[model samples]
Target chain A: MCELLAMSANVPTDIVFSFTGLAERGGVTGPHVDGWGISFYEGKGNRTFKDACPSSESHIAELIKSYPIKSEIVISHIRQANRGCVSLVNTHPFSRELWGRYWTYAHNGQLTGYLDKFKVSRFQPVGYTDSELAFCWILESVVKQFGEQEPDDLNAVFDYIAGLADEIRQLGVFNMLLSNGVDLMAYCTNNLCHITRRAPFGKATLIDTDVVIDFSKETTPNDVVTVIATRPLTNNENWVVLNPGEWKLFRKGELIRS
Target chain B: MCELLAMSANVPTDIVFSFTGLAERGGVTGPHVDGWGISFYEGKGNRTFKDACPSSESHIAELIKSYPIKSEIVISHIRQANRGCVSLVNTHPFSRELWGRYWTYAHNGQLTGYLDKFKVSRFQPVGYTDSELAFCWILESVVKQFGEQEPDDLNAVFDYIAGLADEIRQLGVFNMLLSNGVDLMAYCTNNLCHITRRAPFGKATLIDTDVVIDFSKETTPNDVVTVIATRPLTNNENWVVLNPGEWKLFRKGELIRS
Candidate 1:
């Protein structure tokens, strides 16, 4: 098993504080030390930084923690190497383009014998990781049903993805976070939690590291930022834990569906 | 116009020395200062770092210069935007997945009305740059000729890509560098140069910066390394300039086809 983190914001926001807490777990505070990756959606495209090294000791992760890259949507993961060997190709937060839109995905749990179940199609996995294979299958299924372009009914698309998520969950734990620079979807099989910070933002203390941040000072009243992680990063703020086999869709920091 | 840089080597090599010269051209020593990006292939998958700021001043570029992420294949670009706005989405080098392998591309020239000429198909451009549009068209054509799997006859694939490069060059100047991790292809319309360093390695000096490196201390006699750029990066070394409408394919630092 690994760890997952994601963010959806109404405005461009930095994940420095939240990511700092998660980074600690990548080798410092927790056992997830295989590798780590993060993707930040700027517009139609997103930039990703990945390292096969432990995030706590990675120079790239240090750069990420110090450099505040503001983005509306973000997805990140810290791996523990359950299924695949630790390598750059096996790093999480895998990305692919569909319907002219860049899609990013990160998974936290292992799915045993996934290759035998999933059928390969237009999209193929460059890496041997089960997470990447599952991601490729999901995109292949989407393209099969809706053709190359994104369907007119987004609810239908969400429903399709949720159904696929449940199917993937049958094999093993399948906590996942996926996005297309617009909608962020989190599906839980074992663990996932989310918290939305808005107008009356108060001080929050990190659970993993010795850090406290005043959200009110950093955010405007109009800003709505939702952060989702495999485990809650902050102790003071209440995080809504997702039940097993439950999935939620969020757009611009607001939960649109469950 | 932008600037392009690429490398192919038999052994895993760090491009810190060549990249330093190119980084200087991004703002300090030259005018191509809109944005910059680079892709380093580790295996079938590649990791890309991009910034919407000038490479000379970008924190990410600074990190790249300091941290030596060794790779066998590398593609990099610094932009002086003309067609698209200076933003992360429009930064080169653009990448997409094809045949389960990550394919990266960077271009140094423009096509005025690429949208009117090129037809969109399986692959589409996330960014509205002619370079990306041309890249999409090339991949679409490849998929049309060959299925999802890479063809066994690589020469046929290279010929197809060169044909597409010629077609895009008809619209405007189209100097490009493309790779699928294993093969590095450089297509020239106006400016492109390459230098291969091997056994008799000696001292080399950068043109844009006050830095010199002695290859004698860096490599074994068996190593073969090729560096491709929009212009000669080193002042002391003799670089081979590609002719207009010429394209070359390199694998493991050796020129396989032209």
Candidate 2:
């Protein structure tokens, strides 16, 4: 339904190369031309750029192409609307503050009957989209569970989330990627793929458009990068396909679970 | 502007502890009620949820609180619209397919005059938002630079991106975080913060909202985690503050770059 791109590297690297090829699908190669957004983590902060205009024609998009905003981790998205109206308030890669840290999230599937299931206390949807409503509901759930103090059990928390996801998936397709500032996570109920780059670099080609890049020339012996997407962006590379009802955790260009 | 939260851990951990406090800002404590999103990497994919509604009032948000969804890497976001129209097409945490992987992206700052500069050959914005246009432009640029091959020189690419970001920064505030699946890169032009968690677990408390969580009980002795945010997520924990024009790279919950 949409496209996703993410990179986790050992060094401060630019996603321009991969991003270039993916941009084609925003409106040209594929149908996810709803909107686009990308964030480059510089240091303690990040440099982000977003636009509702098509990436194929936006001047700002061109600027990002030529720019080398490097980061160890990066996330980018192009949307194909399903639940929310086509507008900025409904754009992917939504953000919020939790425990003082900035959390970023993006989704790529529809949640049937999500509106009825989700409800917030103080938070209310600004736009009429099931995706956003779901986000708020998740936040409220966490607050209710921990009651201010951060939870110490990580596995238990994940289990709880998995249960929720299972429930949501039953309604419809639910695929997504999320990161705060530290690590990245991806889940796929229908279609999702991923690639991890290590010291031994290789070549990759864009599937939507005719674009390619050699990793050997762009990385050192110590660089490790991992990318996650709803579909394989490159036609040549052996992208890892995720099974239905699958999820993965990545840190420093390595897959902890599959 | 929007808020972001991320956590990287050596062992599986739950974010509910921190999420509890963060959810407060979704309209309860802060004003980022436009929408919210979160993704947790469980095994190979991720468990993601979003809501067009406020985190405080969404049923999905409440579900997240009750859910466990423990993950080594997590990304969450709450939005305050600035660019795209308020709708689902404009939601954050956009996902796409690239290089046989799912890529996710989210942004927090605004970019003026982005529409005038971006032009995508294949990728076009489905919705009308500056964030989406930027994402497409970056994707297009990557394709243009390296055709059918991944870049071998990451440093060169980073430099190129940095230059591009500098240009974009001239337009407006550019703060962001990006990750593919391996490592994380954080850049701060304005306000962004981060903290790494390792062997020694500690206690944390939320600043924007009144919440606290102790990590020591839930983590193993060898646990290592890192958190990143627009602002320090915890008031008690010592969060690293990024300098203007500074960037940091992370790998496996450890700081690779200062």
Candidate 3:
């Protein structure tokens, strides 16, 4: 019912080009027109911009498009309002601090009876969205299972997340993007695709807008940048769709295989 | 040292004019130019804008100045880095969620050996800053003393905060502005001032800038807006200075008393 977009890069990079394509679908090209939000991680902290307005026409979104705030990890969402009211509090890409790291999350699908099924602790959802409630439950479970310290074995953590995603998928579609400024995670049940661009990156044209960008001119030969979205933003790029119940993790734009 | 600014209003009011004056102090008029940040509460969730660059020269600050984002509670800070490095993570107006409500804080002074003295649990600081450490301690203490739920007696909570402020002030100057979207608290150890403007408002001129705003034209008769800053922002208005170790709680622009 919503759109999700995220970026992971070897170096600090801006998502202006990719975000532009997604912003168009928020209102002009597609039907998701409720609200939108984006988070850019800078080390342990993150800067977030959220607006309860159509991203295609929002002034904040316009600023984000024009100004280039480079970051190593980024997550963005455009909402269509499936479970919560259209307001600033119910905006997507919710964040909470855990393990001395800021964790940001965005969801693209709806869940049923999530409040009754999920168990929450330390982290609480301030908003009334099922997406936020699910995020809180995930974080609380992580803290409870792993104690206060950051988990040592990332593979085990990813496997745990995959199991949680499977359970959440039972209620309904569970597609999500989560990051802790270091590792970017993507879980897919219904719709999620990703593309990684590296040295041989050439021109890529947006599917929604009449815009073309030559990544070779903008990026260094060594730069590795990966973008994940609910649907492909560029028609020319080969985006790999994730199988249902599959979860993947990326660090420095490279997928970490178990 | 840093410059702190906050506002509490009976209705959702824009603090653009006041923020403009503070923005001038960030680099144009004053030396506190390491970074700046602001938190605007829109119900339980708050929207934050932070920049490592000086506010006077930041594009984000320009957007904040031009756009009118109305809020009932706001907390802002302009840092002259002393205790922490000049980066986005070290920026002031640090925020965390507790008791299902977002708590935001900004400090105007530095503490010595804060990490050694402050006791922290449950809540942790993502960034390395003496101010943020103190905030974590306060929130942790509140949770440890109180329970999971929001305290029933707000006055008791304020008193508890005042006691914690006193303890933190013993280390060094500890002027701070804290809020939970519903209540705004000001703690003073050295420099802090406040002015409440209601009906029968008059013209006010900024001390840091040449801009002048007529409050009577912009405000309604029923509007009550109270602004707290490290120093009086306006040159013509009378600002009540707080005594050392004094803490004041405000709700809906009115000072709360025992």
Candidate 4:
């Protein structure tokens, strides 16, 4: 099993505080110490940092903790390595370019015999992991239905992704975080939760470490930031847990319903 | 114009010493202060770090200089922003995956009306840069000629790339460094050079910065390393300057002719 973390913000917001909590769980407070990675989306461009080393001790991870790289969308993962060998290729938050847009994905649970059922084309997995295979399969599905151009109606694409997620969940646990820079689509097959903070935000305490941050001081009245994770990072926030087979679409910190 | 740097080695070797000199050229020694990026290939997987800030002042660049994240192939660039905005999307060392292997590219010169001359289809440019457009067109050409599978006889592919580079050079200055993890292909239009270091490695001094290193202390007798750049990175080394329209392919630190 692994852990997933993501963010969709109305403004260019940094996830340093949330990532600090998650990085600690990579080895300090949890068992997922194999590897960790994060992606920051800046406009149409994305910067990703990945390593096979434990995030708790990684020097790159330490830079991420202090560097405030702001982004509208972000995806992160910490892996425990069950299906593939612990290497850079097997690390999660896999990314591929589709329709000229970079799509990133991270998974929390293992899928049994996914390679046997999924057909892949156009996109291929560079890594030998179920997560990367699943990502390629999803991109293949998108390419099949949408071709080289994205659909005019993004809601239609969302519904199509939801359909694909439902099919993937049938194989096994398939909690995932996926984004194409503009929108973030998360599907929960087992355990997932999210929290959106806006306007009059208050102080929040981290669950993994004794760190508290006052969002009211850091954010303006117009800022809206939504964070999704396998588990809630803050102890005081009222995170909305998703039911099995449920999926949600987020853009600029707000949920969208098709 | 931007500056390009690359390394191909028989063993996993870090470019911290050379990169330190290049980082100095990013802002301290040269005027290419717009942005910078680098790609490190670990097996089949590649990790990239990009910033729209000057490499000389970037904390990420500092981290890269100190972190010994060794790799057999690397491509790095420091931008002066001729054809695109100074943003993460426009940063050099653009990459896309094809044939289940990640291919990275970096350009050091401008293209004249390349958008009108070249047509992009399967591979599209995510950023508004002539360099990215050229890379996509090159990859598209490769895909059209070889389909989704890499040719078993890689020399055939190399010849095709040399032909394509010759054509692209006709349009404008087309100095480039491209790699698919296993092989590194560098095309020179103007101002490109390379050097290969092997048994009985000697001390070298950087041209852009005050740094000296003895390769004999760091490398084994069996190690073979090749360094390529827009200009010679080290002052004392006998760098082989490539003629205009001349390109070279390197595999395991040795030149593979087209």
Over B1-258, each residue of candidate 1 has an lDDT whose tens digit, in order, gives: 889999999998999999999999999999989999999998775999999999999999999999998899999999999988998999998888888789999998878766777787688888888888888989998998998887789789989999989988889899999999999999999999999999989999999999999999999999999999999999988999999999999999999999
The value of fnat for model 2 is 0.00
Docking class of 4: high
lDDT of 1 by residue, A68-148 (tens): 999999999999998778999999899998888899999988888677789886888888889999999999998888887
**Superposition TM-score, candidate 1 onto the true structure:** 0.99
Q: How accurate is candidate 4 locally (lDDT)?
A: 0.91
Which 10 residues in a row give candidate 2 chain B its minimum summed lDDT? Answer: B94-103
lDDT of 4 by residue, A10-129 (tens): 999999999999999889998889999999999999989999988999999999999899999999999898888999988878888877888899998888867686777578888888
| Candidate 4 local lDDT, residue A161 | 84
| Candidate that beats the other on DockQ, 3 or 4, i.e. the better one | 4
Q: Which ten residues in a row have the lowest lDDT in candidate 2 chain A?
A: A41-50
User: How much is the lDDT of residue A2 in candidate 3?
Assistant: 96
Please estimate how well model 1 matches the true structure, expressed as its whole-model Cα lDDT: 0.92
Stretches of candidate 3 exceeding 4 Å from the true structure: none
List the DockQ of the predictions in order: 0.79, 0.02, 0.76, 0.82
RMSD per candidate (Å) reads 1.0, 24.2, 1.1, 0.9
Better of 2 and 3 by lDDT: 3
| lDDT tens readout by residue for model 4, B5-71 | 9999999999999899999989999999999999999888899999999999999999999998899
* TM of each candidate vs. truth: 0.99, 0.50, 0.98, 0.99
